[model samples]
Target: MDFTRLSSVLTVVGALMLPFAPASAATLTFEDLNSGQASYDVVPSPYKGFAFSGWFYGPDTVYAPASGSIDLFTDYADPTDPGAYVITSNNAITSAVEFVFDGAAFSGYSGVTFELWDAGNLVATSDSLPDSQGAAPYGPTFLASGYSGLVDKVVVSGVQGYFSMDDFTYHAPASNNVPEPGSLALVLFGLGIGGLSARRRR
Candidate 1:
């Protein structure tokens, strides 16, 4: 077998398999919390196999654009405000982050901001949007992260508490342990060629 040809085939096959690999991504729909609960002290809950903390999730979360049922939000009875909140993943989930800001009608909208983090290091931030589109059911602002996966946590702020969010989506990084079927076939073909070349030399 020609070693050079084998190396080349394996490299090519590996590259070709990436797009087919399953990224274990998931979304938090905030549908599990009881509708009557209202607090930021809830224990970490697991959703779609990922555990997350920070922020509050319930029916009080304003209006969800996608689920139209419940959402994750930061707000409470206004005797005192509940400041900025966070949504943290217990695992290193990466890539294709997305969410919706369910803002409501309010006079001085303080805008909404988010910070993506990996291992306590900041990764990316969405430009703070005051949603100047005017209030009275502050038109939901959809946000996506510029950075993908390895982001383990997110700090949500600047909405000043009484705000809503829904459909927190993210993807896990593609695994390197498995080969796609297409790539495996290509590898077998390359091996056959190598075998044939070796046999011809005899």
Candidate 2:
């Protein structure tokens, strides 16, 4: 057997398998929170997976969206004040970060703002709601993609905390120990054994 030709074939096979590698990703819908819960102080809460915190100087609560039965957290009691909610993942999110923000979910008139950040820098900022198209029964959903950076937390702020959000999705930040594609690993293993066999034959 020609070891040189075998090596080239394995190289081609490994390259072809790159796109099939496993991806790291996650999503949060806030649907697990109990309806009508009014504080972040609840221990062992539904948001345990996320380091969730609410930051509103006034009243805040989690309730279902208008015309929909999904739970959302907001401080809509005064649809005229400013408040925010922050959630941090156990690991950083490094790609295709996105979430659903329904500004009108609170009053169908007010808009909200969102900020993505890491431990030190701001990653991205979303526009005020009622998006360019005006408010609808369902608020606007924001999407941030293609950028390459690590974000561990997302802050949602609104004048009066009257906005709603759900379906938080993102690609989890990769770890240093992440493995290569299975096919590539197999190819490498085969190459290592073949190289040893050729050495013995010589």
Candidate 3:
């Protein structure tokens, strides 16, 4: 049996599969929030791959961001005065990371409390971070770190007036326990060839 050849083939297959181990990222730009209808519009539940919660603003309507696009803002329609908006994804976010936004519109004192959750269970939370610290403004980006598991839900609350959310980002792993079809096929092919050669030698 040509063990060396089989080892080399398996190594190549492993290399090809390495890139898939890392999570794939997806971003919700909020550009299509209004469906190109108007500048000011109310966000709906399950818009742009995200499920929203605690949104009572029926027609209060949030205006466009500094970029003049349909973005996410605090809900004033809800009697909850200080509202905490929740956005949850349908899939699991293996790595809950930062987002992009340009905040500080009403005042520089704008702060937010970010909470990360996984399937209704709390995972991690961030201190009240200033709006202008992460991105330019009206942008992100909640910077989260030191989390053991992934999160699919995020809760964000504003300290001052309404803050804008230009975009949000999250990552989803390719597959939890499978090697993917293509990679798996290659590995089986390599083994088959080695097995055939050994059989012929017998």
Evaluated at residue 90, the lDDT of candidate 2 is 22
Residues 1-202 of candidate 2 have per-residue lDDT tens digits of: 7767677767876776665554555555444554454443222222534544542211223333433344344433444333433222222222233332222223233455556676556777756555224433334344443345556556655533445545555554444354567855886787678777867888
Candidate 3 lDDT by residue in tens digits, 126-166: 55555455333333344443353566666665543345544
Model 2, position 23: C-alpha lDDT score: 53
Better of 2 and 3 by TM-score: 3
User: Alpha-carbon error at 64 in model 1, in Å?
Assistant: 3.9
Ranking the candidates on lDDT from highest down gives 1, 3, 2
Each prediction's TM-score versus the true structure: 0.56, 0.49, 0.53
Q: Which tens-of-lDDT digit does each residue in 52-150 have in candidate 1?
A: 444555554344345555665454434124443322222132323332222222222345666777666887776665644554545455655555545
lDDT of 2: 0.46
TM-score result, candidate 1? 0.56
Off by over 4 Å in 3: 1-20, 35-39, 54-68, 76-109, 131-142, 145-148, 178-202
How well does candidate 3 score on lDDT at residue 98? Answer: 32
Which of candidates 1 and 2 is the stronger one according to lDDT? 1
By lDDT, the better pick of 1 and 3 is: 1
Indicate which candidate wins on lDDT.
1
Task: Flag regions of model 1 displaced more than 4 Å.
Answer: 1-20, 35-54, 77-110, 176-202
